[model samples]
Target: MIIQGFYNIIDKTLALQFAAPDAMKDPFYVDAYNALNHFTGSQIVTEIPLKEMQSYINIATQYASQTYNLQWAFSVMMGMGAAMNFSMAYGRRNITKMKELSGNGFTSTILFSCITAFGVFCIVYPGWNAVFITSQMGSHYNVITEHLCWTYTIPLLAAAPLMFLSYFFMSMLRSEGKMLWVVLMIVSSLLVNCGAGIFFMHVCHLQLSGAMMGTVFAWLVQIIWGLIIVFGVKGSYLKFGWKDMLFLKWQNIVAFMKAGLPNFINNAALVITSFALTTLVVQLPNQSYNNGISILQELYSSITPWMTIVLSAGIGLTQGARSIIAYNYGAKKYNRIWQVLKRVSILIIIWFTLMLVVFICFGGLMMQAFAFPKEYVPQYRWWIVINFMTYPCCAFTYIALTLFQGINKSMLGTFTSSLRTFLVILPLIGIGYAVSMATGNPIYFFVFIGLNDLISSCIIVPILVHYWFKYRQKLVDLPDDFRSTSINEETFKDSLEHLSKTEVTAAKEQTTPPTKKQS
Candidate 1:
C-alpha cells in the first residue's frame, strides 16, 4: 500500500501536466536538450506526438511521469531489498543466537531506523515545499517554474538515501552482531540526526532542508561507526576473520538473497504501483488538484517519524519475544510461550489503542503545526481526520503480522505484508481515481486511503484468528526442564567452540585413515 501511495504521487504529477519538461523554462533550449540527452536521454522526451495532440500529450505525459517515478522507485526498492537480504544473511541459524547477544548492533539498527523515519517525517510534514520555495537564492525566487523543479527534487533527494542507509545499518547490525561497535555507531548517528537538524536550523537558517542534511549526516555516522567498531576495536565479534577479510562469501550472500528475494520483489512491485497511482492522479485537469493531493500525502509522510519510532521499538521487542517463543516452542514448553504471547499481545493491543486515541484526539492540533495554505485547509482537515480513523485497522494489521513473525510462520507474514498493498491498496486507489473522475467529488479521494486499510483488515483478521487458534498450542509446548532454565551468555560461546573443535578433529581423523596403506 505504501508503494501504491507512492505511485499515486507520480500519477498526480502526470495528471497535472507536470510530468513533461516545459521547454520554456530552459534559458537555452538547445543546451537543455543536449544536457538532457547526454545525462538521461532514456527518460527525456525524444519525438513530438504526431496525432491527437491534446490526447497524445495527456497519454505521453502520464507515461513519462510514471516511468520517471518507476525508475527511481525501483532503485530505492533494490537498496531496501539489499538491506533485508544482508540482515537475514547475517542472522542465519547457529552463527550467534539472537537470544544471547551484547553490544550496540541491534541498538544501532533501531536508532538508524528511527532516525531515518524521523528525518523523512520532518522533511515531509510542517511544509518543506513552503520553505523550499521561499528559501531560494537570488534570481529564482520569483519564478514558479524554478520553484516547482526545486520543490519536487527535494523529496526524491532527501528520502531515497535516508531509506538506503536505514536498511544498510540495520542489515549490518543483524548480520555482524557487532554490539559495542553498533552502539557507538548509533550514538554518532543520533548526534548526526540531532546535530544536523540543530545546525541547519540554527546556524545555516535552513529550516526543513536541515532535516534532510541531518539525515545524510546520520548515515555517514553509522557507516563510520561500523568501520571503527570492526577495524579499531579489539575482541569484537564484528571483526572480520582472515578468510572473511580476504574473500567474499558468495554462498552466504546468495543464501541471504534467496531468503529475502520475496520481500525485494514485493517492494519493487509496490513501488511500481505507487508510481502508477501518482501518474493517474496527475492526469487530473488541474495542477492545484495535484498540489492538494500532494499536501495530504505530505501530511501522511510527516507521521512516519513517530510511526517509525513505534515500529522500530515494536519490531525490536517483538524480535526478542520471537526468539523466546522459538526457543520455548522447540523445547516443548507450550504453556510458557502462551503466557508470554498473551502478555505481549495484551501490551501491544493496549499501546496500539492508546496511540490511535492520541492521534485521533490531537490530530487537528498536529495538522495545525504544518501551517498549510489557508485555501487547502478544508480538504487537508478531512485527510488528517480520515488517516486517524484508519489507525486502529492499520495497527491491527501490523500487530497480526508481527505475531506471525514471532511464531516463525513467515509465509503468512509475507502474505499479510503483500496483501496490505497489492490486494487492498491498489484496487482502492484505482476505484478512488475512477470515482473522483466520474462524480467530480474531491472529498471521495481521501476516503479510499482509510477504506482500503479497513477492508484489508476485514479480510486478514479471520485468517489471523484461525491461525492463532491452530498455533496457540505450539507457542507454549516446551519441555518442563527447558522451562526451568534461562538461556545464558556462555552457552552459545561454549557450544560454538566445542562444535568447531569436534568438526576439525573429525576431519583430521578421517584424513589419517590408519593402515590404509597396508591394505
Candidate 2:
C-alpha cells in the first residue's frame, strides 16, 4: 500500500552496493534489500493524536510466549498528530486554530515532500544512470538500466505530493470517522488503480511508471473526493482555499515543525537501529555460524509479508481507537483517554495474540502455504514463536507513544520511540549473542528482538505513571472562540445519553420497588 516494486527496486540495488557481485540472492543481498527502504524511507510526519495504554499485569500471565505486530504504525503518527490537533482545536471550537494546524500540516507535508522528491530525482538518478558509487570490485549502481531507473523513479517522484496530500486530507476524514464515504472513495480508487496499474505494468509495458501513475490517479480520486467533502460539507470546520493551502504560513509551519521534528528524529533513529540490527544478522556468519544464519535470513525474507499483516492488523485497531482518544484528549476528557486506551489495548492484545498463536501453532501449515522447505519449518516456527513475545510490549509502547503525542507530549513520544530503538534494543543483542554462543542456540537472536521490546516497556512504564499523575485532571483551555460542538460531545456524552440512559433509568425504576404505588 505504501510504495510499489518500483521503490523496492532500490532495495535490490542497495544490496548491489554492499554485496559481492557474484552473490546476488545470498543473505547479504536479502538483508540489505529488505532493510534499504526501511532505513531510508522518509516517514515521521508527526501530524497525530495518541492513545494511553491498559492494565500492566505481568506479561507472562497474559500472553505467555506468543506475540503479534504492524509495518507502518508509526507512519500514522504524522496523520495522527494533525488529526488530533485539529480535533483538539475543533473541540475547543477554535476554527482558526484547527485550520491553521490542518493547513500547515497538509501544506508542509505536500510541499516539502514534492520538493524533496524532485531533489532526489536530480541527485539520486545520475548516481544510478550516469555517475556511480564504486566498490573495490568496481561500481555497483552500474547494473541498473537507465530506462528502468527512469520508469520507477519519475512516477514515484511525481506521485509524492499527491500521495502525501491525499494522506493529509484522509487523516481528517479518518479522525472524524467519515468511514462510509471515505471507504467508498478509497475502494473505488484502489480498484481502478489495481486495474490500471495492471494494464500499465503488463499490457502497456510501462512497468513501474504505470504502477506509479495508477497510484497518482488514485490519489487524484481521493483529492477530488476530499475537496468536495471538505468544502461541500460545512460542519467539519477544516475549510481551506488556495491561499490557505498553497500560500506559506510561517507561524503554522513553525508550530508544526516544533511539534513534529522529534517524530522525524525518532523515525530516523528507529530505521538506523533496525539497519544496525540487520547488520548483526549479516555479520553473524563471521561469528561462529553455519547454514542456520543464512536460513534465518531467508526466513526473515519469506515471512515478511505475513509479519506485515500481523503488524497492520494490530495497529489498525489503534488507528480506529486513535480518533476516540484524540477527540477526547482535545475535549479535555483525560480519563476517557485512559479508558479508551485500556479498551483498545485489550482489543489489540487479544487480536494480535490470536494472530500469533494461529501463525505459530500452524507453523507447518504456513510454511507449506509459502512453499518453504519442510525443513525450514522449525526455524520459521522459532522465529514467530520467539519474536511473538514482543507483540503485547510493542502494542503497549506504540499506543503509549501515540497517546503521549496526542496529549501534546510530542517530545516524550519521540523519546519513547528513540529510546526503544537506539538505547534499549541494540544493547541487548550482546546478551542474545552470548546466550546463543554459550548454548548453541541460533534462535536466541530473534529472542533479543522481543526482549528489547519488553525491556523498553519496562523503561517507559514509569514515564506513563508520571504523566498520568501530572495530567490526569488536565483540561483543554477553552477560550472565547472555543465552543463544544455536537461532534466533540457526541463521542463521550452520547454514549451514555444515546445508548445507556434508558437502560440505566429502567434499571433504577425496577430496583426502587415501585414505591408500592402508594398502596
Candidate 3:
C-alpha cells in the first residue's frame, strides 16, 4: 500500500469526490477498464502490483460487467486470449518468436478492444436503452445508463492498448528479474495518471471523462518509455520483417492457443457469468420490499477497490512464484518446480489466514474509506462481513489457479475456472436469486456470493490437484515455429523463415550419410 500510496490516495479521495453534496456520480468514475481487460498469467504480475493499476481493474469494471453488451464481452475474451499467448511465449523464453507474437497479440487484441469500444461508442447516438442497458438497473438509470456505457467503452479503448503493449515489456523485464525497472515504469505511469487526471478535471474541466483522459495520458507515457528502454538495449529487440506476418502459421497459433487460450477463456467466462449474475441479483421479484438493492450494489462496488489492496498483496506472492515457476519449467527443473509450488502453498495458507483475520476484525474501517452515506451503513457493514467470510476461499482458489497457469497447464486451469465460474458459481447464484424471490430476502442473494466461493474452492482445489499429479513430469507442447532457445538476430530471422517454409521442407530433414570406413 505504501509503494502504491498514490492510488490509495486517489481512491480514498474519490470517495469524497463523488460522494460530495454537489458530486457528479456519472463521469468522474473509477477506472472501468477491467471489465473489458483480463490480463492473462504474467500480465497479472505486471499490471496488478501497483495500487493504481490494480484499481484500474476497479469495482466499476466489475459492476459494469452486468451492464456492458456482447461486443465488450468478446473484447475481454480476445484480450485475455492475447495475454495468454504473450505469457506462454515468455515462459518458454521464445525470445526469437516474441516479436511476431507481440506484433500479432498487440495489434489484434487492441484492434478488437478498440473496435468493440468504437462499436459501443457508435451506439451513443441513442438505442442504449434497448441494446446495452439490459441490466435490471436499466429502468432505474434510464438515459444515464446508456450514457455511462458509451463513455465507459472509451476508457476500455484507451486502457486495453496501453496494457497490451506494456505487458510485452513487463513480461520480458520480469523474466530477466529486472524488478527495479518494472517498479519505475509502473510508478511513473501512476504519476502521469494522477497528474493528467487532476489537470483534466481541474484545468480542462472534462469532469468524468477527464478521468479517462488522465488514464490515457499515463499509459501513453508508459508505452513510450517502455519502447525506448526496450529498443535502446543493444541487440535486445528481435529483428523482424513485414514478410514474417504475410502468411499465417495456423499450427503455431493453434499450438500457442492450446496452452494459452484457456486462461483467456477462464477469465472471460467468469466476467461473462458475473455479468449475467449481476443482472439477476439486482432484480428480485420482491425488490421493492427490500430497500432497493441497486443502491446497496452500487455502494458495494466501492468495497472492491479496498479489497483489491488485500487481493493484490496475495497475488503479489503468487506472481513472484509464477515467474519463478515459468522460468524453471522452461529449464526442465522439475524438483525446483515442485519446491516452488510447495512454498507458495505454505505462503498462501499463512497469507490468507492473516488476511481473513484482519478483515474480520477491521473490515468496517476499510469500508469507511468509501465514505458511504450514513443511512447505508448497515447494508454496507452486512456486505463487508459476508465478503470477509469468502476471502480464504478466494485466496486458495487464486493460488491454485495461478499454479496451473504458471507451469503452462492452462487448459486445466481454464477448465477449472470455467467450471467454477459458469457451472458451479453462477448456478449457485441463480439458486440464491430463486431463494430471494421466494423468501423476499436480499441477504440470501448476497450470501450466495460467499457460498459460491466455498463451493468453487471445494470443486476447484480437487481438480487442480488431480491434474497436478496427472501432468507432473510431462513436457509442455512447443509451438511449431520453435527452432531453438538460443537468442540471436540471424537465428530469429531463420525462425521466421521456418514458419514460411514449404510443407515438404518443414516435414522432412536432409542429411548426408558418412562414408563407410571399409570403403
Best by TM-score: 3
The reply for model 1, stretches above 4 Å from the true place, is 1-93, 96-166, 171-188, 197-211, 227-237, 249-251, 261-344, 406-410, 477-519
For all predictions, the C-alpha RMSD in Å is 13.0, 16.1, 11.6
lDDT for 425 in candidate 2 is: 70
For candidate 1, write residues 1-519 as lDDT tens digits: 121122222222222332223322333432443353353645554432221122222222222332233333333333333333333323343233221222222333333344444444443332554332222212222232232333333543445544444445444453344445545665556656666655654566443334345555766666666556545866444444444433434443443343333344445455555544444544433235221134433343334334434444444444344445544544556676667767766666666567677766765555443323445555565565664466556555555554554444556766775665577778877887778778876445557756866787787789878876887656544334421133333785787899999999999988985897766
Candidate 2 segments exceeding 4 Å error:
1-78, 118-154, 207-214, 261-270, 286-295, 363-375, 429-442, 469-519
Alpha-carbon shift of residue 8 in model 3 (angstroms): 10
Q: How does each model score on lDDT?
A: 0.46, 0.53, 0.55
RMSD of 1: 13.0
Candidate 3, run of 10 with poorest lDDT = 18-27
Residue 379 in candidate 2, Cα distance off native in Å = 4.2
RMSD of 2: 16.1
Whose lDDT is higher: candidate 2's or candidate 3's? Answer: 3
How much RMSD separates candidate 3 from the native structure?
11.6
What would the TM-scores of all predictions be?
Answer: 0.57, 0.67, 0.72
